[model samples]
Target: MPIYIAIFCVLPLLAGLIPEYLVCRFTRRKWWKVLPPLAVAAITALVTAGRLSVWESDVSPVTQLLFVPGVPAAFALLGTLLGWRLWKRLWGPRVVKDRRGG
Candidate 1:
């Protein structure tokens, strides 16, 4: 149970990081901007996969619709929003002073 919880928690983070790293390494675009959507997508994918794999034998419609995707989707949204806030705080704006002729 703990292992399952751990896997659920970590998989989305890993999935989020993969796209961030790829964008940073391969393209000129800022990786931070892409993280939120990617994180959400990744979390969704992970949750869906986990549900299908773990409960395929004993699946029911309610479990299929609610438990399998709902929690992770919520987590993904929260995580992405948090990540975006952090990214903004960390990398947003710049202070520059005007240099005028003396």
Candidate 2:
């Protein structure tokens, strides 16, 4: 049985998270959250374009030039969330009181 599910999920999640984590660590800023998804989206777009641009492919000329193969923001956001959740779980989440009564 192929472990394609795990492989695909883990790789993109890490790729999306690492840069975001590092930037947040160094800058200690909340705005750094934007970086992860945007970076991942850019990477996805570039890779898609690169693959489509190869010879003998039927990719549209506009797609090759504009690199608009697919939108990664949605997937990127999902990956970012998953990565953060995994990281937090590994490190142990901090104890915080909930304002809402449970």
Candidate 3:
């Protein structure tokens, strides 16, 4: 019971994280950050809709299925923003060293 719930929650996150991280690593960049994650969530929701009932998605008022996948996008957005923030903080400026010393 709990295991299924865990899988349901984690599946979207993993699906979002892995690809976004890979893109980040290679490009060292983000595409409006949240957009990519949102895309991931949308696709995941669409693909898994068959496995999940409308009730599972829309009922319970808390475990809404439609929005579940977007949870991953929030994390992904946070990661992307944080990554860019850190990168800018660490490397956004140029360091100058005097070429000529007396």
Candidate 4:
């Protein structure tokens, strides 16, 4: 039970942190920063849905590996949002000062 919780809940959230930081750090545009992670989440949801819809007795190894539970994606979304907030706080837009006394 504990292991299941850790794998499904804790690990994904932690896994998500890096991608978000990298995205925020590398991407200059606001849209660019957000698009990648959302695309990941969307892809995961689609895959999960497709797998669930098709009833199969023999699941492929690839499919099994790719079979990500929805919880992880949700947690990851939360993690990305947190990362964005942190980035905004740390390296967000700054107010430029006038060269001469205004």
Give the best candidate by TM-score.
4
lDDT of 4 at 72: 76
Q: List the lowest-lDDT window of 10 residues for candidate 2.
A: 65-74
TM-score of each: 0.47, 0.49, 0.41, 0.63
List, in order, the clash count of every candidate structure.
0, 0, 1, 0
* lDDT (0 to 1) per candidate: 0.59, 0.59, 0.55, 0.72
Ranking of all predicted structures according to TM-score, beginning with the best and ending with the worst: 4, 2, 1, 3
**lDDT for model 3:** 0.55
lDDT of 4: 0.72
Overlapping backbone residue pairs in candidate 1 total 0
Give the deviation of candidate 3 from the true structure as CA RMSD. 6.2
Candidate 2: tens digits of C-alpha lDDT, residues 1-102: 245434455455566667655554456566776778777767777777576655456765655543233433344567687656665566645888999978
Error of 3 at 61 (Å): 6.2
Badly placed stretches (over 4 Å) of model 4 are 54-68, 93-102
3 versus 4: better TM-score goes to: 4
Best by lDDT: 4
- Give the poorly placed runs of model 3, Cα more than 4 Å off: 1-52, 56-62, 94-102
Clashing residue pairs, candidate 2?
Answer: none
- Per-residue lDDT tens digits for candidate 1, residues 1-102, read 887665555555454544444444455566555765765777578767776655556657566756557655665555555655555566668787889875
Candidate 4 per-residue lDDT over residues 1-102, each given as its tens digit: 999778877777766766787789888777877675777677677777776744464656455544365667777777777777777788888898889977
